[model samples]
Target: MTGGPKASRRVICAALAGAAALSATLFPGAAALAGPADKLRDSLSRGRSAEISAPPIARFVAQDGRVFVLDRTQPAPMLKFEDSPEVWVLSPSPAPRGDVIYKNDLGEPMLRATRLGGVTLFSRQRPAGEPVSLAGGGVPLRLGGLSPQALSERMLQASVRSGRAARRQVVFEAEATPASAALIADAAMVVSLAFVRLAGRDRDALGQVDSVRFSEGRRPSASLADGVLTIVVSPGHGLAGRPSSDRVAKAIRTAD
Candidate 1:
């Protein structure tokens, strides 16, 4: 009878020991999972918004080693570069007012803008002999001998077309990239974009961007380093503008 009670006591002690060992084994894993979850929640609570600053005059370098400076503060912002390609005006913002000028790797001038009545226009002045054709869903406007202001009006009268042939849309989509998408996001802006080759070389020497996110409808600005290409765009109020299409076109034209 004594042996029976002693055996029961030994069994109860063994069961208790097993339970404690199992708990000890699980504690580290449970703590590990909780740690990451707690960190993520804290990060979400402290998330910050993007900041906007005054527009800065930007400089663009061409494949031919030409440098162009654009001062957005000027009444008619112009490009200052020697032997530079023709200046093209791309997007102008502020609704029915604003202008951006740019040149392509080929050094051609392509202009896009909007008028007071919310009309959009795209203009490209090819080399003296290059072909110029105006065809779209809307009536073609005669572009000859028209001042920039008048030309913008006539172009607006013409129907806006879709596809690769549309100069503004083409340039708009071309300068887009993953980094630019992040910038647009930071600015709380959205866009529709397609991926195009980097401005200079096929093999990008620029390091991989880890913190950037690319999406459809957003475009990146042009950048080059050690033969690699990197473009970044972020979101912010100061980045707001009208005729984003034109801005995109100008960026493409100016990219090396």
Candidate 2:
């Protein structure tokens, strides 16, 4: 009868509708899942880069804010920074919680408070060798400038005040929230890295070593080239018996 054909048609239509509903339920669009800020936060949280734009201005922000970086510290064969900045954004990494300003390509920072209010304050990018106003950004933040040595002292004092000491930390003098911060002593971003010979090349020799740690009392930096390891620390920090340590010898041999 005609009714049999109509009944089958209705069943097929219902099934298709049900399938569409289920699909919508299972795979929601990205906007439905997360807002722009939330997406940026998540992207940075995983040590990725995020480009944020607030009309007339857009810059890269590294979710990972580390001032002191050792290049190729741990090479993963080849490292790709799809999300991180190309030239180390040098901005504050978001804290475990709370809001903060984001920095830009020219090192000038901008503020965006998304929740309680939705307002963005922008600033002119600093020209090279020109003084940058730490307070120019409309955000009400107390920014401090210090040499790396002075910042190290402040960190020591902070640890004393809190009665919690961190043996080694890469911190900045900027007014970071209760959580994180840094500033380059001279340049906005200072990259101190060395070449290591690995597998007959400097890289091959250097890659054999797991990590390079500075145990000296004065925080020093290190570089490796042509099988020689150079340690540079503040004057008067004893270096006797440091390079002679068996660990150092092993690291050297591993590199060699």
Candidate 3:
């Protein structure tokens, strides 16, 4: 089920707003780190390493073009897909249980960590068409400067191949928000989709998201189009579970 033009606009607008808010929160102490664009470039220059001791906050560009901000403090890294990496991963002080794997474009594994205390990973890769697939039922999602039509088509193909009903929807758009735009512009590919099932809805609300995980504070809200699904990630603002879900739903409904 594709969204109408109005719905698309709404989604875009809401996304822009949410993206802006997210950016502010993620880099609270980065005022000295320059703007996101500058910081992004700085982060990219320092390539990822295989060193795994304490989960260090690092950044990398996935083959698909998504900027991943990994926080080693949680049980696992929090992931969000946009033009840039602004999503935050949170866990208890003891750190949670999860793993981080570094791989190249060919699906070859590089570094894998079994425990992450509290670290972050950022990426310098621009939008590019590359395939990245995770362990399990994850399909590699392509990321780059794709036209809406082109992105839609690729999503359709992926859905057909995966045998899952693809849902596409236009959430929103915003030009006034540079931060939001930056997040979207920085993504080069879709790495993995982490599906989280909402209670009471036998269906996983985030079943179609392309990233391995959405940021800790964000909840899953999405719309399905012709074989394409667009999931919206928003700041938690101290909310969780169904409230977060509803916030995402409302944002999508009011996007653009």
Model 3 lDDT tens row, 1-256? 3658889899999999998779879977765556777855654465333234422454444555454434343433343344532243332222124444443222233334443222233232322223332312221222224355544454444333323321322132222122222222221112111111121232234343332112222442444444233543332221111112233323223334
Candidates in order, TM-scores: namely: 0.21, 0.18, 0.23
> Which consecutive 10 residues in model 2 have the weakest lDDT in total?
70-79
Per-candidate clashes come to 27, 16, 57
Model 2 spans with C-alpha error above 4 angstroms: 1-51, 54-89, 95-256
lDDT of each: 0.32, 0.32, 0.35
Judged by whole-model lDDT over C-alpha atoms, candidate 3 comes out at 0.35
What global local distance difference test value does model 2 have? Answer: 0.32
Report the number of the highest-lDDT candidate: 3
lDDT (0-100) at residue 182 of candidate 3?
Answer: 23
226-248 per-residue lDDT for model 1 (tens digits): 32223344322123211133343
lDDT (tens digit, per residue) of candidate 2 on 26-73: 877844666777866776576543222232222222233211111111
Q: Cα lDDT for residue 197, model 2? A: 15
TM-score of 3: 0.23
